[model samples]
Target: MGKVTGFLEFERLEEGYEPVEQRLKSYKEFVIGLTPAEAKIQGARCMDCGTPFCNNGCPVNNIIPDFNDLVYKQDWQNAITVLHSTNNFPEFTGRICPAPCEAACVINVNGDAVGIKSIEHAIIDKAWAEGWVQPQPAAVKTGKKVAIVGGGPAGLAAAQQLARAGHDVTVFEKNDKVGGLLRYGIPDFKMDKSHIDRRMAQLAAEGVVFRTNVVVGEWPQGSKVTNWAKEQVSAESLKAEFDAIVLTGGSEQSRDLPVPGRDLAGIHFAMELLPQQNRVNHGGQVENAISATGKHVIVIGGGDTGSDCVGTSNRHGALSVTQFEVMPQPPVEENRPLTWPYWPMKLRTSSSHEEGCVREFAISTKEFIGENGKVTGLKTVRVEFKDGKLVEVPGSEQDYKADLVLLAMGFVNPVASVLESFGVSKDARGNAKATTEAEGGYKTNVAKVFTAGDMRRGQSLVVWAIREGRQAARAVDEFLMGATSLPR
Candidate 1:
C-alpha cells in the first residue's frame, strides 16, 4: 500500500467524458484519461487488504495490488510490466470492460472502490507514449505450426502467446481486418480501431502471420453474421497443414425475434446495423447500408448491444429512440451485503443512454406493424412475472410508432458451419465442447483441435475471452511439447 490512510482521504475519481453535443457530431472516442498525478492518487487508494479480491474478480487475474503500488511509487514502467504479465491487452479492457474488479474491491464494501480501470487506462496509455509497449519476439523457433481461427480479443491473445512461445502462428479472419468483434461488432465511438491496428503491428512484428479476409469454413448463404471475407479456406486444409488448431471463432448467431413482421424491410439484427457503421467509419461502403437518420427507431433487448444502438441512432440523428427490455428494471442501488465481491445487478445507464433514449422495462413486443413491406410501428404489452412465468397485462396492449427496429438480443452460438466443418461436437447450448481442466483444457473431440473464448463458453465479456485465449494458448503449447513455459 502506498498510503495508509489514502482511502479515507480520497474519493474515487472517474475518467472524464466529452460533452454530449460535441461528441455526438462525430464517431470518435471522447474519454479524457487521467493525468499521471491523478492516476497516482487513484492508485494510492488501494489499501493493504490481506486478500486481493480484485485480482480474482478480474477475468485475466491481473495483479491489481502490484500495479497500484507501482503506480503510487511513480514507477510507471513497472506498472505496465506488472499489468502485461497477466493481461495481454490492458488497453482494450481498460476502455470497454465494465470493471467487475471494481465491484469485487474490498473497499467497495463501505465506500467507492479504487479506480482500477482508470488507473489501468492511464498506465497503458503512458506505456505507449513512452515507447515501452514493444514487440517481444521469441528467442528461439520451436518449428511447430499453429492456426488460430477468428481474430477477436481471444484469438489475438492466443496468437500472441503461441507466437511468443516460438510457434509459427497464423490467424485466419473472415473480416477485412484481424479484430473480430472488437473491429466490427463494437462501434468506433466506443473504441477507435487504431488500438487494434497498433496491436496488429506488434503481433506481426512478433512473427504472427495474419490472413485477413479468409474464412475457415462456409459462411451460410444470406446470413447476417457480418462477414466481409472474400475467400474461403477449407477446414481440411487447416487441419492438414497446421500442427494444432484453436477455434476462437465468436458466437455469431444473432438471436432473432420471430414476430409477425420479421420480414419487414426496416427490421434487422443488431449485427447488420452495427458492422455497417464500423465499415463506413473505416472508409468502406456497405450496399444499402441501414440508416437510422430521421426515423422513429426502436431497439429491442436492453443489453450492451441495445445501448450501442441507442448511441449510434443518436449519432445518426434519429427522430426518436426507444429501447425495450423484457425484464424489469433492477434497483438503482444493489443490496451490497447480498452481492458484494461479485458483479451486482442494478440499473446501468451507458454513455449512450445518457446521450438520449426512452427505456422501457418489463415490456415485450407482440407484433410489428408494417406497410408496403416496411415497418411502421410496434404492438406491445406490459409484462409481469408470476410463479416464475411471464404474464402479459390484460389491458396494457398498445402500439407505438417506429420506422426502424434493431434486434440486439445477444447471440446464441457460433456459426454452426465452422464447428461442423471441424467435426467438433457441440454442447447443449451449441457452443464448442472443450473442458477447462489443465490436463486436457481446450481440447476438442477431434485430435489436434482446440476451442476457446465464446466458441467454448458462449457469449461473454471481452476480458473473459482474453482469459480463455491465453489459457488455451498454454494448453496447446503443452500439448505440443509435453510441457509449456507460457504463464497460466
Candidate 2:
C-alpha cells in the first residue's frame, strides 16, 4: 500500500463530464479524464485489504492493488504495464464497463470505493500520449495460421495475443470497419471511435491482419444485424486454410416483443437505429435511416441500450423520449453490508439517462397501436409480482403517444446461421457450446474450432469478452503447439 491511511483521508472523485447542453450537439466523447495528480490521489485511496476481491471482481482479473500502488507512487509507466497485463483495452473498459471491481472494493463496504476506472483511464491515456503503447511483435514466427471470425473485442483480443505468440492471425469483420459493437453499437458521445482505430493500428503493426467487410460465414438476409460485408468466405475454406478458427461474433439476435402491431413501420430494433446513426457519424450514408426528429420516441427496455436510445433521441431533437421497463425499479442504493464484494441490483442511472428521459418501470407494453402501418402509440399495463410471477395490475391500462418506437431489450443469442455454417453445436441458450475448463476449454465439438465472448458465453460486458478472448487464444495455442506460454 502506497499510503496506509490514505483511504481514510481522501474522498472519492468521479470523472467529470461536459455540460449536457453543449455535449448534446455533437457525437463526441464528453468524459473529462482525471489529471495525474487526481489519479494519484485516487490510487492512494486503495486500502491495505489482505485479499484484493477487486481482482476477482474484474472479469479480466486485473491486478488492481498493484496498479493502484504504482499510480500512487507516481510510476505512470508501471501503472499502464500492470493494467495492460490483464486488460488488452483498458480504455474500452475504462469508458464503458460498469466497474464491478469498484462494487467489490473493501473501501466500498462502508465508504466510497477507490476510483479505479478513472485511474485506469488516466493511465491508458497517459501511456498513449507518452508513446508507451506500441507494437509488441513476436520474437519468432511459429509459421502457424489462425483465423478469428468477428472483429469485436473478443476477436481482436484473440488476434493480438495469437499474433504476438508468433502465429499468423487474420480477423474477419462483417462490417466495413474492424470494431464491431464498439464502432456501431455504442454512441460516439459515450466512447469515440478513434480509440478503436488507434488499437487497430497497433494490432496491425504486431503482425495481426484485419480483413474488414469480410464475413467468414453466412449472414441471414433481412436480419437487422448490421452488415457491410462485401466478401463472404465459407467456414469450410477457413478450416482448410487456417490451423485453427475462433468464433467471437457478438450475440446479434435481439430479443423481440411479439405483441400486436409488431409489423408496424417506424418500430425498429435498437440495433437498426443505433448502427445507422453510428454509420452516419462515421460519414457513411444510410438510405431511409431511422430518425427521432420531431417524433414522440418510446424506447422499450431499461438497460444501457435503452438509455443510449434516450440520449440519441434527445440528440435528434425529438419531441419527447420515454423508456419502459417491465421489471420493478430497484432501490436507489444497495445494502452494502449484505451485498459487499459482489455486484448488487440497484437503480443505475447512465449518462444518457441524466441527459433526458422519462423512465417508466413496472410497465409492460400490451400492444402497439398504429395508424396507416406506422406506429402512433402503445397500450400498456402496469405489472406487479404475484405468486412469484409478473401479473398485470387490474384497471391499470394506459396509452402513450409514440411516433418512433425502438426496442432495446437486449440481444438473445448470436446469429444461428454463422454457427450452423461452422458445424458448431449450440447450447440451450443458442450460444456456441463451449466450456471454460482448464483442459480442452473453449473448444467446440467441431474439430479445430473454438468459441468465446458473446458467441460462447452469450451477450456480456466488454471486459468479459476480453477475458474470454485471451483464454481462448491460449487454448488454441495449446491445441496447435501442444503447449502455450500465453497467459490464461
Query: Roughly what TM-score does model 1 have, to 2 decimal places?
Result: 0.99
Please provide, for model 2 over 80-193, each residue's C-alpha lDDT reduced to its tens digit, 9 standing for 90 to 100.
Answer: 999999899999999999999999999999889999899989999999999999999999999999999999999999999999999999998888898989999999998999
- Give a tens-digit lDDT track for model 1, residues 1-488: 89999988988999999999999999999999999999999999999999999999999999999999899999999999999999999999999999999999999987899999999999999999999999999999999999999999999999999999999999998888888889988889889999999999999999999998887877678854444667889999999999999999999899999988889899998998988899999899789999999999999999999999999999999999999999999999898889999999999999999999999999999999999999999999999999999999899998999999999999999989999999999999999999999989999999999999999999999999999999999999999999998998
Give RMSD to native, each candidate. Answer: 1.0, 1.0
For all candidates in order, the CA lDDT equals 0.94, 0.94
Residue pairs that clash (backbone atoms under 3 angstroms), model 2: none
Off by over 4 Å in 2: 223-227
